[model samples]
Target: MRLHEYEAEEIFSKYGINVPQGGLAKTTQEAVQIATNIGVPVVLKSQVLVGGRGKAGGVKIIDNLNDVERVVAEILKSEIKGFKPEGVLVLKKIEIKKEIYLGITIERTSGIPIIMLCSEGGVDIEEVAHRNPEKIFKLSVDTLQNLYSFQIINMVKKIGLTGKTLIGVVNTVFKLYQVFKKYDGLIAEINPLVITENHEIFCVDAVLEVDDSALFRHPELNKRKLNNMSERDKRLMEKGATFVKLDGNIGIICSGAGLAMTTMDLIKDYPSLAPANFLETGGGITSELMFDCMELVLEQPGLKAVLINLYGGINPIHEGAKGIAKIIREKKVNIPIVAKALGNRQEETWKTLEEAGVYVIKESETQKAVKFLSELLGVKK
Candidate 1:
């Protein structure tokens, strides 16, 4: 549910936040036209989800039409952080007197939205926080009251804002907080919220990550999807399987989000194991859904083995085992599957797997399961 810069800017603009005029272009000619329309000294930015676009040569300054065409051609031809550049955002370049970073994200430990502001901008916020923690100001907003005016004013003052620009910064913070609450956003950020040479404040870059669970409430936001998903991802989604491809080779299928994440973390503990996807079948999933999930995992060419770790609380373990056996037999899948079933109906699940001649580890411990799966893949320890 991460949005592209243009998409995020559109949301920000709706909330009365100031953003530079820009348009998305799919071709070099279209990009050149957009630059010409926005006037000279435009910035050509690749609309990819990955970061470090400038370091990766996905961003360039176009002083004229020639630079526009040249830069657009280069950006469109480049790949940043493994994501192929598909489109370019041509935006009016501004003369910045200063750059600041402002963002809001859910705190994993506290389960609260934390607002972060820093005077250092135009760089990775994480790097800044890591190097100089004192410079970054953090405020946790109470979900009950949302963001208050005094809190916003305090944050701006902490960042040392002054004059009319201070008022603009305070207003932007208020508007951004409203947008975050309105959309049930997981994250909303404006990197390098810049002060122009004329003392006007504007968001130079924007990023928003809407909570996927909240998508049903916002039809308009749902339609504004960005083309950030990969070809395999699109295929998996179309097939009705909950799939999230990861950097590892071990394919994981669990019945809960907690278990799926735990499986991934356990795999990381072993040097030789890397999970390929975070596939959750969810509780009470039918045999058909199980078949779909298994098929999706097997579709990955790099998948070395499949791990089925289900603590069936609501779901009957026998049904899950039966589904796995059905998919394996019907699809003639060759990848090794290691099953670790626990919780209600565990005996029935083990019996079903044994009857089907599937590898049943009969372990409730996640670490032991990881060890067994790693060994099955010819990895020691």
Candidate 2:
């Protein structure tokens, strides 16, 4: 789950990563008090889960003590991209000599955590990647081994840091890696990891995102509510399924997470076609489960079609097909439904789905099936 900057900075402080003095305030009075305690020339940052807080005017700087209350009140009243601020982070502003980017995240294809560092920072890394991909340097971490200081030094040296600065940067990066490993973090980032005028390093902006699936292991971190979880998400969680709603027209159901993601990516490949949701029914599929999954998918509004990508590795494809067909018949679903069911009892599954008027594809390539779904939605490209 994504963490507010205040919360992320708190975690960073515990790991010996330097961060500007800050406190979280939910009220204007509290914000004023924190600002007074920390002294003036403070930055008032809106504690919103979404990004673009600066562009949305959710962030403001107050140099005068009298302006703290007014700025805090203004920020508290504002929302960033439809997400209201939960609180305001009052931090003492520091002078920056240089800004660098440091981040660690699990790479999808390799399933290995990769550390990304760039000399250009204080902005979205994605923008930098697209505009100047060569500026970013990546190092894949072997989860089984410790992240050595030498490895971090080698990567950062190429960015042209040496002497005391190199030592400090290496130490900070190593500590950040420790924090990433200890918290089961999906993403731990320190944007604009700054070098102050005094030549001291500090994490000016922090972002820590713990893996939701691994939250059970960290009781303290797990206490925070899973932000923005819908009733549909809660229901799916209770039923041993994973579902992520998206803004699109195709409802996707797959037997595996990889397949579900692959299907979503392929649908996105076509112009004007996107997957409406990611629904993965992990092992032990049955007709009843299939029927329930279909009902859930159909409940979503603005869905123009449904795509089912299932593999019968250890699942009963024929039996699951019965449940899907049963639900479509009962609900009288008119939107196009396509199923690419492959594996054991494939022909039987095909017969059941086709008889229920659901288009069936017996091919191994999911792109072909996705193209067919795009055609049904009048978005084939």
Candidate 3:
């Protein structure tokens, strides 16, 4: 769940991180009131979930009270990347002497969190990484243990952060890490972390992304929309199923969480194969439940093929075969299927499915399911 800018700042402030004085405004009148309260020379930022707000004229700095209403009125009426402004963030504009970037995110391959520091800030980090990769410094931290003081010192030295500014930056990151861990966050950053002329360091911009799986730990965030979940998401959640929609032509239904995740990962290795979703049917799937899962997959748009991979352990292969065969026969569906029913009574399961004209693959042939599904979808390997 990505938090709104104002909300991120609010959460940061609770952990002793300094942020500009700001409030949310849904109307032009409310925006002017916030500016008046914070005093003039304030910045008005459009509070939309999408990016490129500044380029789209969603951000403006006003020094005069007369122009606050008119400028904010225009911003409120404008849209940024097809997203209408839910509100505008009214903040006291800070004069930045220097900008730095500090953030924590999980390294995909290593599956560990790392604190990243960059001297080049206020610009997209991705742009910096691509153009000036050496400018960014990284230090991987073990979440199970407390952060070492030496790690901070090493980062301070590596980034050339020195003196009072160095001292302040170290303390701020210490607190920011706590917020990151406490919330089961996926990524947290204070980009454009600024230094004022007076040598005071403040995080001018904040971003916090919490893992949806850990939302039960933070009840207060219930008000904030997580991934802007749609009706399909709501239904999947109700069924206690893990289904993440992806842009692809093949839809997958597998048993077991670990197996489903592995299947999706394997699918990525084949460029011709792309999965529409990660749907896992837990242990002991009933006929009705199996039908529900199949129906859900069929509803997905742009889907060209479906694969049912079952490693029958607790849920017998016969039950899964009966369920899928019933759907094919009753619905009279013509969509191609790649069913891999392994373990107990696998022979009988394949027989049942083959009678329904479903393409039955073997345990040894499971590895070729991706290529087969790709061909079913008419994608060149």
Quote each prediction's TM-score.
0.75, 0.74, 0.68
Question: What range of 10 consecutive residues in model 2 has the weakest lDDT sum?
Answer: 225-234
lDDT of 1 by residue, 117-186 (tens): 9999898997998899999998898888757778888888998997788888889888888888889988
lDDT of 2 at 331: 92
TM-score of 1: 0.75
What tens-digit string does per-residue lDDT give for candidate 2 at 1-381?
677899889989999999988699999899889988999899889998766678889888889989988888888888664457889999999888999999999998999999999999898898999899999999999978878888998999988888888888899999999899988988999998998776699998899988768878987766664445556455556667776555577899999998999999998898777777789987677897788789878877678899999999768989999999999889999999999999988999999999999999889999999988877767756
Model 2, global lDDT: 0.86
Residue pairs with colliding backbones in model 3 are none
139-239: candidate 3 lDDT, tens digit per residue: 89987788987798778788887888888889888888888988888889998899899888888778888877888889778545534665655655666
Error of 1 at 109 (Å): 3.5
**TM-score of candidate 2 versus the correct structure, residues matched by position:** 0.74
Candidate 3 displacement at residue 232 in angstroms: 5.1
**Which candidate tops lDDT?**
2
Cα lDDT for residue 278, candidate 2: 80
Candidate 2's C-alpha runs over 4 A off are 226-233, 243-255, 268-365, 368-381
Clashing residue pairs, backbone N/CA/C < 3 A, model 1 = none
